[model samples]
Target: EAAVTQSPRNKVAVTGGKVTLSCNQTNNHNNMYWYRQDTGHGLRLIHYSYGAGSTEKGDIPDGYKASRPSQENFSLILELATPSQTSVYFCASGGLDRGTGGAQDTQYFGPGTRLLVL
Candidate 1:
């Protein structure tokens, strides 16, 4: 099973400040993703990584940056936080399924991080 955890479950940041959200996974999955949940937009993908040392821009990657330093760690960085970015962020990990030997559509997600930018 995939086990993902996120740090700073709740955060309050100032406008134009910097915020870093961290995620760690123990499933050894090759794919990791960062997403933000909003009321109207639902869950929007901000960034994703295929593996360590590789990062990719997602559907909504304008102001967000992602990093995957190791197989178990992935981080989301907001260099200049804004009030519009305030939302609940989630980290997910998924990849090939050992049992099925096929790509797993099931993604294990972290509890979520609530960020309030003011």
Candidate 2:
């Protein structure tokens, strides 16, 4: 089973502070992703890694950076936290098999990490 978990399910940060969010997966999946979900908007990808030692910036990589030092762990770093960055972040893992035709690679998501900045 592919299982992903995130730390600090809730957080409160001051402006310009640093915040680090961690994620761990037991499924050993090749792809891991970090995303933020906000009301009236779809989940937006922040960062992703194909495997250990490889991290790539996603669509909304600004104000955030990512690290994947090992196969089981990935972290998201906010160097200068801002109230605009407040949102619920989710960690996810994608499996290789899509059941048929590889048309759908389902991404299993973690509960989420809600962050508030003030």
Candidate 3:
């Protein structure tokens, strides 16, 4: 299983400001994902990466940017933070299943980062 971690477990941002969330994985997983968890609503996809130097937009990519400079690191950037963006962010790492040679449905998740926008 991959070990995932996120920085600044808690944060307070102002509207129209910038906020950056960072994630790192110990295991060399080919896929990495960013998700946000909110009240009344479940988790929503923000962005994802297939491998180093590759990033893809997920279901909710607006007002956010993703960067995957290396296999072990991925970052989520909010150029203009908003109150609606206040939520708990999670990072997950997943790869193929050796047994089936198929994508692994089980992903290892980070502790999560909580952001409160003012």
Steric clashes per prediction? 0, 0, 0
lDDT, candidate 1, at 98: 76
lDDT of 1 by residue, 15-53 (tens): 999999999999899999999999989899999999999
Tell me the tens digit of each residue's lDDT in model 2 across 7-116.
99999999999999999998777888999999998899999998999999999999999999999899999999999999999999876754433423568788899999
Q: How well does model 3 score by local distance difference test? A: 0.93
Question: Which whole-number lDDT from 0 to 100 does residue 31 have in model 2?
Answer: 85
What range of 10 consecutive residues in model 3 has the weakest lDDT sum?
Answer: 97-106
Specify the highest-TM-score model's number.
Answer: 1
**lDDT, each prediction:** 0.94, 0.90, 0.93
- In the order shown, the candidates' Cα RMSDs to the true structure are 1.3, 1.9, 1.8
Q: All candidates' TM-scores?
A: 0.94, 0.92, 0.92
What residue pairs clash in candidate 1, if any at all? Answer: none
Q: 2 or 3: which has the higher lDDT? A: 3
C-alpha-based local distance difference test score of model 2: 0.90
Which is the better candidate, 1 or 3, if ranked by lDDT? Answer: 1
- 83: Cα error in model 1, Å: 0.2
* Most lDDT-accurate candidate: 1
